[model samples]
Target: MTRTLVDPYSVPDELRPYLQEVVQRTHALCGSDLVSVIAVGSVALGDYRHGRSDVDVTVVVDGTAPGPVVPELAAALAHPALPCPAAGLELVVYDRNFTARPSGEAGYLLDINTGPLLPERASVDPSESPAFWYVIDRSVALQAGRVLYGRPAREVIAEPARADVLTALRASVREHSSGEGHLADNRVLNGCRSVQFCRTGRWQAKRRAAEAVAASEERFRPLLRAALHSYERPSRTAATTLPTTDVHTFLAWVAERVDESSDADRRG
Candidate 1:
């Protein structure tokens, strides 16, 4: 749906008027016919820090006419007043065809149908799936941040979801597993973060998945022995590769099982 959390009064003094002016100018330029324009990412979440964090904005329009509006909106945001001094602005344009889809993370969705502004939705409850953990984990650490629209940061941080929010963490670990070396290293790091969140019940499934990953390690002697009990040799040469696609897929499947079990435990 269309959600806008603009609070012009909350912007910093030096940046306040400029942002409001830009919004006004953009509205005038586009005849204000678009759907909603809300601030998201680090800034909207109030975790932004200066000299870091871009001015993240989302302008949801009515039709498929985003192509025509891009240049106008960009010019307005980048005008001399703001000049996009810091991390620059990320602009996303979503039309009616776009629907909120769950982001594999608890209650979160991929949000934008297209563009570079695929920032996660800020949930009211920190425990909701697809909460800001992805952003908290990946987005450049905010030196400072402020809301320029809709709801207050506290409000957004208080809403709860149907399930704990860590499911997305597990999904991210599985989905982005192709690269090796440093990329593989990043995946492992993210996997570790997922584990941390999961351990807190924010992401129950992810915690279990992390446990499974830890258990597979050569250092976890007893767990490895247990794994060896049920392990069966695959009939192919490709099966033994540590970083193979098959291995990742298998890990993801196992992770899903772990998540399911965690859910069952909660139910019981």
Candidate 2:
């Protein structure tokens, strides 16, 4: 199916009416079959940025379809007049069976039970796999989406706590950073660091310090530097492995330092 491009911000006036029409059309196509159409991703989270996002919508049918509906949905969204702004639309089709299984990709689970038609399920319990972070972090932002049937957007994503999501995010960042030669590893780490600061009002120059350390080395300097920064102060001991406790503690320290820096910034 051809993808539809959409402007992340300021949905075209034409687009709103088109979206309503599409939803109505989609509903009629399904016709009283128990199905749910939900919006998920950046637009759902109220965090969309223009020129850098797309629309993610999921269709959950009561029973498995003979074939994937993603292609069809894409085609519908890509209609010449409709023409989504970015790389068209991203559509996932699921049957009840598909929704029952835990999502293999971490943060991608839609949490259809409680969030909006398109809800952002952000909780990341440590017990959950690092894969969760990979999904959420790498998720393409959805500028806007609607539910064709069943449940409002807020009700679907409301159960998961922000803290749980944050924890999952942290684990994801650590996992990516630990993997060697991943250029985007630093981005994950920085994202986690930013979250930590926001949650606890603390900042660690760890990302910057780690970057410096990595740059100085000829090889995987960033990874090595991250490990060093994760260690407790004065001793400056480095380890071949990254223990979660040590990483968590280091994050805490970073947070404390950030708070201090913020205070200093205010005074200055």
Candidate 3:
């Protein structure tokens, strides 16, 4: 039942209501302006964790909505009022061009970041955000996004390909490795997934990627396990066992792997 609307259903009964609300609200706000509503990230990958993972969604419109419309939609869909059953609903609105193509810059109409795990914020300015996460999210959306409304995902979204992903991975690893206020568990698991992506050029769930890497890279098993343990738990302090020093090392290694992959990709 969880996988009905899309492949490999991950949404449980508890999450269905909240997920439905997101679709309904977006339709209500955007109306005929809405081009597509695609579900991305953990939920699309069948790795969604209730109270842990975000129900990431992307809304594609023909063009920019009325300025006030975006703000209203953001307020309408954000936490407390709508009550995201999962950790939160991360819904981003993009024009058809942005949704259909990959850009190296942060170009979005609206970003609603809400949930208990995250600070509540509905950002309309793309200049205030980084481009890497958006690019990565777009790539995932291109490959795996499930259409919640409007046109099919493939018909509307364009592929960002492997090269774009590796570049984005490099940028992300660099930031998480040195940037302040990043989650340690996220760094480790993301490292595992990035390394796997570098090696295989395939995208997958963080838990799946970590498991695959742990099976092959014996040296990082303990760290991966710690990260996986923390990711599975809903508590904020779940990463207590995740070593800070090792996480930096892992990110560095992942950065190097991304570099190698990037170089190889360029050569080929």
Give TM per candidate: 0.43, 0.41, 0.91
lDDT of 1: 0.41
Cα deviation of 71, candidate 2, in Å: 4.1
Of the two candidates 1 and 3, the one with more favorable lDDT, higher being better, is: 3
lDDT of 1 by residue, 8-90 (tens): 55554545655675566556655545444555554554434344344555544444554555554544455343454433455
Q: Per-residue lDDT for 1-268 in model 2, tens only?
A: 2112233233444234444555555554455543565655544444333333345565555564434343343344443535444323444444545444434343322221111122222221323435444334222211134444554433332222334334445554555445443323234345444444444433334344354434643444444455544432222122234444444444454344445544554576
Ranking by lDDT: 3, 2, 1
- Which ten contiguous residues of candidate 2 have the minimum total lDDT? 111-120
| Candidate 3 colliding pairs, count | 2
Query: Order of candidates by TM-score, top first?
Result: 3, 1, 2
For residues 58-134, could you state the per-residue lDDT of candidate 3 as single tens digits?
88899888888988898888788888777667888888877667567668889889976778888889999887788
lDDT of 3 at 118: 70
